[model samples]
Target: MNIILGASGQVGSNIVKELISHNLPVRAVIRSRNPGFDSQVEIRTADLFNPEQLTDALEGGNTVFLLTPEDPASNDIIGETQQIINNYKQAIHANGIKRVVGLSCIGAHVEANTGNVLMSRMLEQGFADLDIEKIFIRPSYYFSNWLGFLETVEQYGVLPTFFPEDLEVDMNSPIDVATFIAKVIAHKSRSSDVFELVGPQKYSSRQVAETFSKLLDKHVELQPVPKEKWNETLASAGFTASTTANLVDMTQAVIDDIVVPENPDAVCLPTTLYQYLKEKLEK
Candidate 1:
């Protein structure tokens, strides 16, 4: 049996659908019932932080897809991740699951000084000694995250950003990420491996704005917010102090180029930023 945690999320849901499209039976472990999934998929409701509940959900599963959701309400980012890793450890042991595919970030190879990347880095490290065969999919930033900026563009004719305006960065659609995961599941090879996923094209903030302009048929300018004012801006935006601080650190990592893909020769997924944006706009 194959199990998928975070089944309601963008990447996880896409993965669930992809697996089902291939006629693979999947057990979706979710915190709450979401009727979005097809009837062929099995549903298991459990709080991910609950060891007993998670263990029960993993019962008889041979493979598992793991991802840790962010809890901005918590002040202790590292502590929260540690507890999650611990829970996964306990659940994996209880079920004796052997094959695994983990969703991680691109900068996960950085051992230190890369704020949010540390959470992913530590996640991969935690699974190192396990006897199970594992493949970690470290993808670039999700293109879906930019959807939130469309409202700003529509209202103010500008897209706000924290990073440098011309800094080129990797991007990928969640659908593409899921498709790659399905491929990995079908062809499980290495005992432990990492695949760096990215969209067909890299985009800077200006390029992003240009893409938006082309899609929206309006001139959307790039508004680069100075890093010094992030705290005040995030606070005004209603983010908790801890969440704000964590985001600031992660943004800094991007500015420092710590989140760039480790493998320059990594294959680009079929989806492009323009294609993703076009789909969203058309919808």
Candidate 2:
């Protein structure tokens, strides 16, 4: 009944876990054939860029969950999302997915002109013309994004970034977003609702550094890495300059409050950054 894409990723994994536990039949499409998911759900693989696979994957499914990340090529997000539109048009005309919950950003549609907003903006267009229920769950900065720096911290006691030490950004753990998606999947009544999955409070980079210190029991420092240093740092970590620049834009966007989504339903969660960090460190 439900075809969830990117089920191997964090948010997708959470959705799969919740779906299986509830005894709901789910069709999971991944970039890879082996995603190590539960056997109760059907697992399939398809290249999102390949139209035939994408269309075949959408067959017999009434709902779809889309998770498209930024591509470093062309810097044309709308152009990239157009690929999805051209590819899925046949499937849309045939299978007719009733609802689409797109995982997008706060400025997804607004930043069409900006190169960094291309992917999300394209994703916005990918579903805009569809004749189906749509809910764009644009989440704030994922707290798990910090996990990328955990290796850096383990190697060196420093966390490098483009944001200021005291610059506060809205944050939410992936658990929050995943749980919200799960709630949407479980409740047929919740649709056409654009929810801003965010943390209950705001947090600064300095506070994040403090949280890391407490979690790691080490003096982890937040050192503001210059743009040049960012290039070398990310390159050493196996990322391209375009990817680095995209992240810089997003980080600055967070600092400028350009990417903060409004609270539509005011849903509350029991976990905090401390709780999330604690469990991660323990693991």
Candidate 3:
């Protein structure tokens, strides 16, 4: 059986749908009951932080999809994430799981001080010694991240971003990510592997604004939040001081061009920014 953690989330939920489309046996593990899953999916409620609940959730599952859910409001995000990783380690061992497919980030290879990316690094390192097939999927910036600024773009004709106007960054669609993950899980592979996933092309903030302009028929402009105001901006968004600091560091890392895939030959998914935005707007 294939067990999917964080099954309520976008990527996880899409993965569930993809697997179900293939008529595979799946157990969806979520913190709370969600009635949206198909009849074939076995829903299991389990808190990721609770060892006993997680262990029970993993019972009889041969392969597991693992990911650390984000808690941006936490005062100690790193420590909290580490604790969750420890719980997963314990639960995986107790259940004797055969394979683990981890959702990581592009900059997860960096060892120290990469803000949110550190969580992925910790996840990879935490399970390094475990005698199981480990496959880490490191995806670039998600195109869905831009959905948060849709209201601002629609109402004010302005797109707010931390990136520079002309700086191109790798991005991918969550649908593509889920599709790749489902295929990997369905395929029988014994050797451990790391796959870096990206979209067909890189996109700049200016290009995103242009796409919005074209879609909304308005003169949308890019509003790059200056580095000096990152802390102020994040704090106003209701993030804790520590969380804001970490986010600022992560933003800086991106601007400094530190977040690159370790493997040069990354798997490019066929989802352009314009296509993604067009579908989102149509929806």
* lDDT per residue (tens digit) for residues 128-222 in model 1: 88988978999988898788788999888899998899998888898899888977876757678999988888889899999999988999989
The TM-score of predicted model 2 comes to: 0.89
- Model number with the top TM-score: 3
Q: Quick one: best lDDT, which candidate?
A: 3
Local error of candidate 1 at residue 48 (angstroms): 1.3
Question: Over the stretch 32-135, how does candidate 3's per-residue lDDT look in tens digits?
Answer: 86949999999999998899999999999999999978876889888889999999999999999999999999999986578888888899888999999999
State, as a TM-score between 0 and 1, how close model 3 is to the true structure. 0.98
Segments in model 2 whose C-alpha atoms lie over 4 Å from true places: 71-81, 112-116, 263-266
Model 2: how large is the Cα RMSD against the reference? 2.5
What is the TM-score of candidate 1?
Answer: 0.96
Better of 1 and 3 by lDDT: 3
lDDT of 2 by residue, 1-283 (tens): 8788888788888888888889988888888756677878898887777878888888888878887755544344445566765665666567777888778766664652333555666676766676678877777667887887888787898886667788877678888788788778767764576666668777887888888888778998898877657667766765566666666566556656666455556454556789888888888
Sort order, lDDT high to low = 3, 1, 2
Between candidates 1 and 2, the TM-score winner: 1
202: Cα error in model 2, Å: 1.3
